[model samples]
Target: MVKLKIGILGFGYWGKKIYQALRRIPECEITVVCDKRKIPLDNKKIILTDNYKDLLRMNLDGIIIATPNETHFSLAFQFLLKGYNLFVEKPLATSFKEAEKLINLAAKRNLNLFTGHILLYHPLIDTIKKILENKKNLELKIKRTNKVSQINKSEKEIIYDLFPHDIALLLYFFKKEPKIKEIALEKSLVEAHFLIDNEIKISGVWGKGTDKERTITFFVENKKIVFDGLLSVLKLKENGNEKIIKSIDYQLPLSWELSYFLNSLKNKRIKEKIPTLKVMAVLDKIEKLL
Candidate 1:
């Protein structure tokens, strides 16, 4: 079998993880890597460029975009229009219109378009979802806070950048859009709070002079499962008794997601994968409320 040549755009914080994972995949070869600014060389094998158009000249099977939220639509548009398979980072795009455009284009081209919703690949999260399925009723609370960034961003709120993970997870586990009964939002240039789904509430703060604190809690019939994201541990409680659930110390999520994508590309159609149009539609609704 011929190995698929993979090109990654935006070799920034999260992109490096996906780049590393692509290197590890035996079926895919990391032929090109591009970033807007100069990045230090991680491996000599990676052909680095500042311009993404340079990548199109090379024979490429797929492209992964880990750039800023705003660039997702335009960059993906360029590549998917050329008929290359794509792995786009979360939220699909900054808006529902762009997401739908990308989806429709990918479908028309009969190419794979996978979202980088890495949480969907987390085994521990999947376990929690299974446990919640057996319960009668539940409410979820997701708290995500991080220290302020030195970099300036246009989409300068936590809701747009961070809450997508929670939104994607809620849609995945609940399997339907819950009536967003009410929303309480406190907005600033950097931070925001969104209380969504009458039962499920999410509080988010992202800006300067803050330490990282991420926690997700699920409350249900006689049970509670709290996810401490920073610590990467889950605390489980049943009937008011609490115990910590150990997460399987695993490799990075992008690697798992890429591996899954590889298998899906080989064995299943792109539409069959998680975070398909169905999932993106739910995200569109959540984006509106955000």
Candidate 2:
């Protein structure tokens, strides 16, 4: 088996997860890593650098940009231009222009490019999608809240940091862009409400300076599926009886995503794996809302 050389940038919360997960894959080798601050690594063979350009110089099979929202386009652009396969974290680009440009550029160069919409790869979500495909009169409601963290310091609002996960999963399930018919923005507070498809509602709040709650509820006929994001479990109710599902604590999904990207890279067919242009357009609208 040919091991692909993988380089990771950003080295923050999600970055570290990607780095650690990729390191365990037998078909993968962490060639280099970069971040704004010094971070310890399990393997000394992994070259750590503050300047991304330096790591970019190392001959690698792929590069994963888990950096800030602002630097996504530039770094990915340079790497893609050099014909390196890319695995970018969610909200592929902060702007539509950049997202569209990168999507097209990856196609023109025939390079593997995947957006890290991790939720879409979850086993429960996959099950939910399959169930939805066979059910009618299904109503989905999702609510998520994050703990008080410095990550939301982007000054972009909770929607940018939080909504993309739900939005991408919503689009993945709907398999088409739903018209965001109603939007209710709360003022003088830390929470906002949005109504998409006129049936589903998403309300969120952060920066409360206290404990947080993250949950998502899906209503289909007589069954209710509630997802506890913080606890990583699913609560199900049927005929007045309820059951709880505990999520497996593992990095299998992330590994699966990376493996898919590697296969796409070898097959030279990653452009199709990206969110459709229409989905990108809808996300652009939500980006503006943020």
Candidate 3:
């Protein structure tokens, strides 16, 4: 099988992780990496570039945009017009209108577009989904927090950063719009209580300056599934019987996501694998409520 030559834009926080995952996938070859800083390259196979423009002229099958949230629109638009398949981190665009345009452009250009909702590909999530496949009702609760000594963004923007994972999970499980009932919002923290499809109740918390925590729990019909955000462990309890469902097998989510992205590009149907627009639409609605 031929490897897909892909260029990556942004070698910062998430970008570095994506780069590592790309190297692990035999189906992908990193042809170029672009960032403002002169990022060190360990592999001679990669052509490191500080200018993103160089990527436009390179022979590439796809481009992954792992840059900051604000740059997603302009950078993604640049590559989509160049006929490259695209992958972007969560919150694909800051706003719904911009996301809509990108999705439409991908459709018009016959290119594949994927968003980095890595949690969607996680094994714990997969286990929970299979467990809940037969259940009639669902309730969702997500808690995502981090401790930051310095303020990097506004409260609302922080909310944007932390909630995309939870929002993507909601869209996958409930497939309904969530309505916010109350929000205890502050510059350093955010909490929201909402309902999905008027049936599934969800309570969410996002804040910094605390012990780092990320956990999502589901409750229904005397059964509870708990996912440890940091550990990627799953616990299931039923009728007062507690059973640890699985050991943390430790599959890198980044690798799985890249494989899915590459397969979607090869198959020419991203909708069948991961529908990013729906996730973006859910994100947009959640942002408007705040």
Identify the runs in model 2 with alpha carbons over 4 angstroms from their true place. Answer: 148-157, 187-210, 271-276
Lowest summed lDDT window (length 10), candidate 2: 183-192
**Pairwise TM-score winner, candidates 1 and 3:** 3
Clash number for each model? 1, 0, 0
Residue-level error in angstroms, candidate 2, position 77 = 1.2
Query: Local distance difference test, per candidate?
Result: 0.71, 0.71, 0.81
lDDT of 3 by residue, 147-171 (tens): 6764656764765578778877877
lDDT, candidate 2, at 262 = 73
- Each prediction's TM-score against the native? 0.85, 0.87, 0.91
lDDT of 2 at 204: 48
lDDT (Cα, tens digit) per residue for candidate 1, span 1-290:
67877888988988887876787878988888899888787788879899999977777877888998888899899898888888888757876778889989988988888888777887778778877774554666666655555443333344457766776776777666545444444432333334434444444444333456677888766577898766667898897688988665555566788887777667646543345555556545545664
Q: Pick the candidate with the highest lDDT.
A: 3
Q: After superposition, how far is residue 159 of candidate 1 from its true place, in Å?
A: 3.3
Q: Report the error of model 3 at residue 105, Å.
A: 0.9
Model 3 per-residue lDDT at 246: 78
Candidate 3 TM-score over all chains jointly: 0.91
| Predicted candidate 2 versus true structure: per-residue lDDT over 1-290, tens digit per residue | 88888889899988988877886778888889999898787678888899988966789888899998778889889998888888888767777788889989988997878888777666777766776775555566655554455334443445445666776776777755566654544331244455555555555443323346656688877788887665657778899998975475557678777777777767767643327455567657755654
